[model samples]
Target: MTAPRSAAPERSVVDRTLSILGAFDKDNRTLTLSDISRRSGLPVATVHRIVNKLHGWGALERCADGGYSIGLRLWETAVLAPRSSALAAAAQPHLVALHGQTSLATTLAIRDGGESICLSFVSNDADAVACYGGPGRRLPLHATAVGLVLLAHAGDLVQKEVCSGPLRPYTRHTITSGTLLKRCLAKVGREGHAVVHGALSEGRGGFAVPVRDGRGVVVAAVGVVGAVDVIRPARLAPQVRAVADAVSRCLRADRPRVAEVGA
Candidate 1:
């Protein structure tokens, strides 16, 4: 038989390592070398060698049963991502306090290349939550309170890109049409906040507000999520606003101030 055309050149070691790292995503937080090799489409030997290197570098940790997971050290490095951490650090205490009172799930998210990534998610009972995307996960931006808020205020180019693409419908309640999305975005811009119901997941309602930096431009978004029946804005709005306002103050505080001589 004629020799089968060889597959494209084997991926480089560097590319394979990156693929291994990316293989551990939200749904699959842990995996074995075999899993990594399969997911990365690299030779098992190559995966083993690189995984060892990553482990030595503290980027990956070995599981008890011999699988691997993202290490805490890696998490520490990721926390330095200003898009996620700088804002989360300022917004966390407020999120914690909010969760304490309402026992709901809350998170801090930032727009990332047309996606929304959750930096922190506070929930006493995450398993019980009907919320989509756990902590340290990325979600599609087409149907989320945080996404709408960020997309609504984003530069015209980003807004146009998001509105022009194929929109997804998560549930019966999701807003899909570009025109409707535009209107919603406009409303969010005018309102300075967004309250969305069951747009991301069934029975899951969320509200989000932009957290601005010194120049008054939004750098990140913060929000809370809970069941539809339990998401009463009359009860939650004040707290959310208070928390969001505090976060904004922090962003403003980080700006350099002119020295005043009062002596």
Candidate 2:
């Protein structure tokens, strides 16, 4: 026909630049030029040019080992995102109070597509379930208490996508069955909070409650994590719910008002 329509059009400069940046993640923090090329599906020469420009602009940094990594400038820009920054600011004080009261790690997370991303984490024990409690960490939607609360409030599309199958099992207790996971979400909806025990990590547990926005839409989840024996859902659920409520109120007050039609 028309020369097979050239398969696909050439990627734009912006698309290439974004692909180069997207190649780096929590696991692949540093990569060589070839590594970027392979990960981004761009030619080595093209990657070299784009990487050089990003390095010059301080969006990428060169390691002593001659590898590339995301730069501090990107982080500086990322913190300005109102979604995470505003939520973190509103939840920090309450999270601190919760941590102080329970002597457990506290966290704030938001759902991004099918995963939960931790925005704020308050904990003295650096090694206590770092994967789940560390800020900027991504977790499965079916595993953690914070994740379950967010998933419970998430739209049906996300639910269907996650429950469609291939659920990863983190531990013996992780809910790998889509049927069981759906039931758990339904229970969380009725209870207004989630108490997960040994799901992500053995001997660890979590408690979470949903944070709603001004329009009463669930926007985030705040929670506490500790040893399974120490979680005590009966005692902690109310406290977690209280902090969530406080954050929701703050979000409602901070929302911009639309002026009256004729005012």
Candidate 3:
């Protein structure tokens, strides 16, 4: 016997709202109302209603084709998030200068939960592999130099969790062995930086250093990427470290002032 649609429990306002927003991602950038309904598994009427509200609030924008995409308002809100915003602001100038001098791709990233999200990037090389992607793109936490440095500083729990198993291989050089990866991460911790060669792509190489917060926490990573032959980690380590240090100082100087109890 088929159950009546009316017999199903109604979704909460929060759940329905989140569903509509969650329907958009890097792969699914824009979608029609029908597409949102299908992806969110909500009734069309519910999707329409929620989407209209979202559009009005500037959380979503209606396209000329009557499709919906994430709005600039939403982006503005996201960039204000303290975790990435403060770090990105501090790192931007350094990243730009590095990119200008080296003519290689320089990227700033922060660990978002389990993934590394690119916050800023500058590159002039058309032939350089897009392993890091651009700003707002997510990269694996175990494949590149930035990822390795982040994982190394992310403490034992994160290292164990990521290295336990199921590490996807992007190339033959990608470290699939949890044991070997653990060793590599240990070395990264000792060196205070990471250098990866052909790990994310067949010919790509990278060098990364940690960006510390006001409290001395490893809040982000800055790195440079290019072809394996020309990207020498040891040679570039000093420059990358200098930039990372400059950003760290900025973070400390620009951080919010704590209130005094008796003031």
Candidate 4:
């Protein structure tokens, strides 16, 4: 009998290209060529050639420190993703109304993997220091009010993963303890909203409510942030919930169009 032929050795250009892109993620946004070589498991010479090509095409950018980071071109392309783009577009009017009514910083965010990614933010407070570099920035699941709301509805697996944490404390009040975070998440679920004080930043209080889709699945969180003393959860909850509900309504109304366009 003839011996079975062995499978050909793998050397895919697509796989190699993807490996380079995969080397950059949340914790490792910028990487030196050596880092990419190690992470991609490719030779330095191969990494060098690929990196140059990617940089030329605006898929990667060279940092001042001679490292590489995802380029703005990639971000600009990412925002056009149908789901997030549609959600943001549908929620924009409600967000604007909320900001106009509250005169505080309001944000819209969706849970992306382990973190909450801000999609839209509006603030008239000139003195308000930016956090996480503003919209498209990622915030910790255990810190912000929006994060709490998102985590509350993100299903048991995500909750357990987050609660089993080396949770970083952004401020003294941030819930680093898994047990404490679990209790807070329970409260958020029961109340249909989340309120956090000085957790993500000093002297900043936040309130958030869930924004659901047509199927009633929680898709995002809408939140407002202001001074600790000024944040009356009782008053803010109603406003936040109202705006979030309005956003949900808009999304549901436009769902058919969204599906058609995507199709």
Q: What lDDT does each candidate get?
A: 0.78, 0.87, 0.84, 0.84
TM-score, cand. 2: 0.88
Model 1 lDDT per residue over 26-95, tens place = 6677899889988888789988999999999999999999999999889889766655555777788988
**Higher-ranked by lDDT: 1 or 3:** 3
Instruction: State residue 184's C-alpha deviation in candidate 2, in Å.
Output: 0.6
Clashes by residue pair, model 2: none
Q: How well is each residue in 1-263 modelled by candidate 2, as lDDT tens digits?
A: 54555768999999999999999877799999999999999999999999999999899999999999999888899988777888898999999999999999999998888889899989997667456646688899899999999899888878888888678989999999999999999999999899889999988999998888777778889999999999888999888889999998888888733111111
| Regions of model 3 farther than 4 Å from truth | 1-11, 125-130, 256-263
RMSD of each: 5.8, 4.5, 4.7, 5.5
Residue 83, model 4, lDDT: 58
Q: In angstroms, how far off is 195's CA in candidate 4?
A: 0.5
Ranking by lDDT: 2, 4, 3, 1
Candidate 3's displacement at residue 46, Å, is 2.3
Model 2 stretches with alpha carbons more than 4 Å out = 1-10, 256-263
Candidate number with the higher TM-score (1 or 2): 2
